[model samples]
Target: MTTERQFQHDSQGPLRRIVSSVFSIFETRLELIGIELSEEKERLIGVLFLGLAAMMLTMMALITLTVLIAIAFWGTYRWQSLAAITAVYVLVAIVCALRARAGLSNAPNVFESTLAEFKKDRDTFN
Candidate 1:
């Protein structure tokens, strides 16, 4: 009876340790995931503000330049200048769309590090 009890205790001890270790590893991964999410959020917010600012400034400059160009050619090549500006804008729009598509395709996957860590853990366990 004592030997059976001792064997049971020994068995429970290693099993408990294994469970605890697994949980600890999972907890660590969860914390890393949280940190990655936070960093991603901050990055996106910063990008949003910066992008908005740049877009606003660019629009203001374009508007001012367009008005100036139109006014200068008002009595001469008014229609021609307008057409030229429209053509330029169309071409720019096309280029910007292409570049944006390329950028999206090339951008790194979000939560890359977390996914990598999970893969490493899986490999380690395996």
Candidate 2:
């Protein structure tokens, strides 16, 4: 009876350790995700504010320049100048769209670290 009890206790010890280790791993991964989320949020807000400011300044400058160009041409070449400006704007828009698409494609996946940690755990178990 004593030998059976000792064997049971020994089995329980490893089981307890396994459970504890699993919980510890989960807690650590959760903490890392929380930290990454906070950082991403802050970065997004900062980028939004900066983008707004840049857009406002660019619009103001474009308007001012357009008016200046129109006044400079007055009667002659006025239509041509406006057409050229429109063409340039269209080209710039296309380039910006393509670049934005490329940037999105190249961006790293979110939760990459978590996935890596899980992979490590799987490998260890295997």
Q: Which candidate wins on lDDT?
A: 1
List lDDT for all candidates, in order. Answer: 0.93, 0.91
How well does candidate 1 match the true structure in TM-score terms? 0.93
RMSD of 2: 1.5
Task: Give the lDDT of residue 112 in candidate 2.
Answer: 90
What are the per-residue Cα lDDT tens digits for candidate 2 across 27-79? 99899899888888898899999989998999899989989998998789999
TM-score for predicted model 2 compared with the true structure: 0.90
Candidate 1, residue 89: the lDDT equals 85
lDDT of 1 by residue, 97-126 (tens): 999899989999887888898899899989
The CA-based lDDT of model 1 is what?
0.93
TM-score of each: 0.93, 0.90
| Minimal lDDT window, size 10, model 1 | 109-118
